[model samples]
Target: MLHARIVRGAERATSYEVTLWALALVTLALDVVTTTYGLEVGLAEMNPFVNYLLPTLGLAGTFVVLKSFALLVGVAAWWTMPSKVRGVVPLGLALPWGIAAVSNTVLLAGIHL
Candidate 1:
C-alpha cells in the first residue's frame, strides 16, 4: 500500500512545476532540432501559418521566443488557477510536448512514422 504525503512547510516548487518545465525543455529541444534540421515531418508542420512565419528569426531563435512566451503563460496560469484546474493545465501541455519530442526524435532518425 502507498500513501500521499502532505507537506506543511515553506514555499517550494511542486511536482507540477518540475514536470512541466522538464517537458517544456524536452519539447524545446525537439523543436530546435526539428526546425533547424528542417525535418518537416513532425507536429511543427501542422501549423502552417506559424511554421511559415517563424523562419524570419531562424528556427532556434523563433522557437526560443515562442516557447518562452508559452512557458511564461503556463507558469502564470499554474500559479493563479485553482488547484483542481491546475492538474488539467499540465495535462493539456503534456500531449503536445510528448508528441513533439517523440515525433521529432523519430523523424530525425529517418524513421518515417
Candidate 2:
C-alpha cells in the first residue's frame, strides 16, 4: 500500500507546480524592486499627490506584502511535497495570512500608527 501510494504521488507532480514556483519568483522580484529599490514605491505607499489615499495605500501595500509571502510558502510546499500532501497546500497558504490580516487590523485599531 505504501509503495502504491508513493507511485501515485510521483505521478501527480505537474507543470502547474512549476508555474506556481515561477509566480513565487516573480512576486519576490517585484517586492524587492518596489519595497527595497524605491521604484514607484513612494507612489504606491505614500502618494502625496492624492492626499486622501495614504491610508488606503498603506493598507494595500501591507496586503501585497502579506500575499507575496503566502504565495511563496504555497509554491514552496507545492513544489516540494508529494501529491497527497499538496492537497493541504492551499490551507497551509491561507490560514496564516488570514490570521496576519486580522492581527494587523487589530493592531491598527489600537495604535493608530
Q: Pick by lDDT: which candidate is best?
A: 1
Each prediction's RMSD over C-alphas, in Å, is 6.6, 11.8
Write down the TM-score for model 2: 0.35
Q: What does candidate 2's lDDT look like per residue over 1-113, in tens digits?
A: 99888555545534244544454455444543444333232323333433354356554565465566667767687778776556445544434444434444444445443
lDDT of 1 by residue, 9-52 (tens): 11122436557567666766666666556445443455675567
Clashing pairs in 2: none
Worst 10 residues of 2 by lDDT: 36-45
Q: What is the lDDT of every predicted structure here?
A: 0.60, 0.50
Name the TM-score of candidate 1: 0.59
Shift in Å, residue 53, candidate 1: 1.7
